[model samples]
Target: MTTTTTFDELPSLVGTDLGYTEYVTVTQDRVNLFAEAANDGQWIHTDPERAASGPFGGAIAHGFLTLSLTIPFWTELLEVEGVTAKVNYGLDKVRFINPVRVGSRIRMTATIASVEEVKGGLQINVDQTVEIEGQERPALISRGIHRFYA
Candidate 1:
């Protein structure tokens, strides 16, 4: 279940399973764009002709591209009200469990693992898993930490 809560209710959100986001297809064009923007034009991520013979069989997305989708997926999972700013503090224990091939779809399921009071704000820790569509093993897992300033 997606959650929308106020800053005042943040404390109660700890340990809640915030549910999954809509599936997003990983496309070759998207991967190529990311590679161009990141200056990481690795054949495995940008050159489909070359990558077709590589291990993954075709170009795959950069791990960081998948990681960057965390924010959009998080938005689908939760929305915090009455916050002037919500900051992405940092991530913890990030792991790319599987390579996301172009044309594959992925989604995320998240849990609010912990919450703590911080100066002028609240610190929230969320455990997130990005699951590949129709696959048993997830594509990625990480702890996303954020600060919501009142």
Candidate 2:
């Protein structure tokens, strides 16, 4: 985990890797809830029996579900003090390089790519990659942007 004493200390983080988070298991219940909420109940994601006979050999998490995990992953990797508000600005580039299977353990690696002064605060760009244990490639690779204010 990476900790910052204050908001101003964020800018000094440029080009530094913020470190990784502990593995979190991808659960069926979580995937099901995400499917229901996103209205994306694809059989490959929600149907265990059917998916068991299909390509991946079993049910897999929705791509969006993996994307959504970024929130908690980032939170676990970064801690800032003296910040009144933090907003998710957007993502620059996102790629789903691998399918996340249920029961898989995944964690995030965060790197501070850049930091710049914005209207009300600092706009920070983080390069994030979600990797599955023992996997050569990451399940998700993205550039996330966030703004922080005092």
Candidate 3:
């Protein structure tokens, strides 16, 4: 479920666990597209046949590709009302903890770690974990910094 709130309501969200997003499958085609877009067609991420014999035993999504999915997963978790713009200010301590193999499903759970008033808007610090289906460890984890502008 999405946690929808106005800019005024942001301050109250500190320490709120926003819950998880719906799962998204990582497909070979999606990996290919991301490889093309990122100009990082590494064998393990783009060449399935060759990768099948490589470590992880199959094509895997690029780390950045997995990280990029954070945006959509985040949107599914929270929505800030009355913001003219949203900026992906940055991330801290981002770690690709596990491989997202092609055809694997993944989802994210988020928490609002903090909410601080920034220059002209609000800065939301979120703790995020992207989990691969049926996996013990998460695929990725990070502290995502976002800004909502008036």
Candidate 4:
């Protein structure tokens, strides 16, 4: 479920665990498109035949591709109401902990680590973990920062 919050509600959200998004299956097509768009057609991410013999047993999504999915997955967790704009300020930290092979499913669990009011907006820090289906370790973990303009 998605949680919508207003500027006034920002303070109360500090240290809140927003929870996980719905699972998204990572397909070969998706990996190929990301590789193409990124101009990073590494064999392990595109050529399935070659990749099948390589490490991980099959084509795996690029680390950056997995990181990029964070945005879409984040929207499923929370939305800030009455914001003129919400910008991805940057990520404080990001680590690809596991390979997300094609045909795997992933979802994100988001937690609000911190929130502070700025001049015209709020600086929100979120800790996100992208988990591969049935996996003990998460595919990726990141600390994402956002600026929400009122």
Q: Indicate which candidate wins on lDDT.
A: 3
All candidates: CA RMSD (Å)? 0.9, 1.0, 0.8, 0.8
lDDT of 2 by residue, 77-141 (tens): 78878888999999989999999998899999999999999987888999999999989989999
Each candidate structure's TM-score, on Cα atoms with residue i matched to residue i, is 0.97, 0.96, 0.97, 0.97
Q: Please state the error at residue 146 of candidate 3 in Å.
A: 0.7
Residue-wise C-alpha lDDT for candidate 1, range 51-141, written one tens digit per residue:
9999999888999999999989998999999999999999999999999989999999999999999999999999999999988899999
For all candidates in order, the CA lDDT equals 0.94, 0.90, 0.95, 0.94
Q: What's model 2's lDDT at 56?
A: 95
Error of 1 at 88 (Å): 1.0
Candidate 3's C-alpha runs over 4 A off are: none
Candidate 4 C-alpha lDDT tens digits along 1-150: 998999889889998999889999999999999988999999999999999999799999999999999999988999999889999889978999999999999999999999988889999999999999999999999999989999
lDDT of 3 by residue, 1-150 (tens): 999999899999999999989999999899999999999999999898999999899999998999999999999999999999999999999999999999999999999999999999999999999999999999999999999998
Candidate 2, poorest ten consecutive residues by summed lDDT: 1-10
**Candidate 1, after superposition: displacement of residue 30 in Å?**
0.6
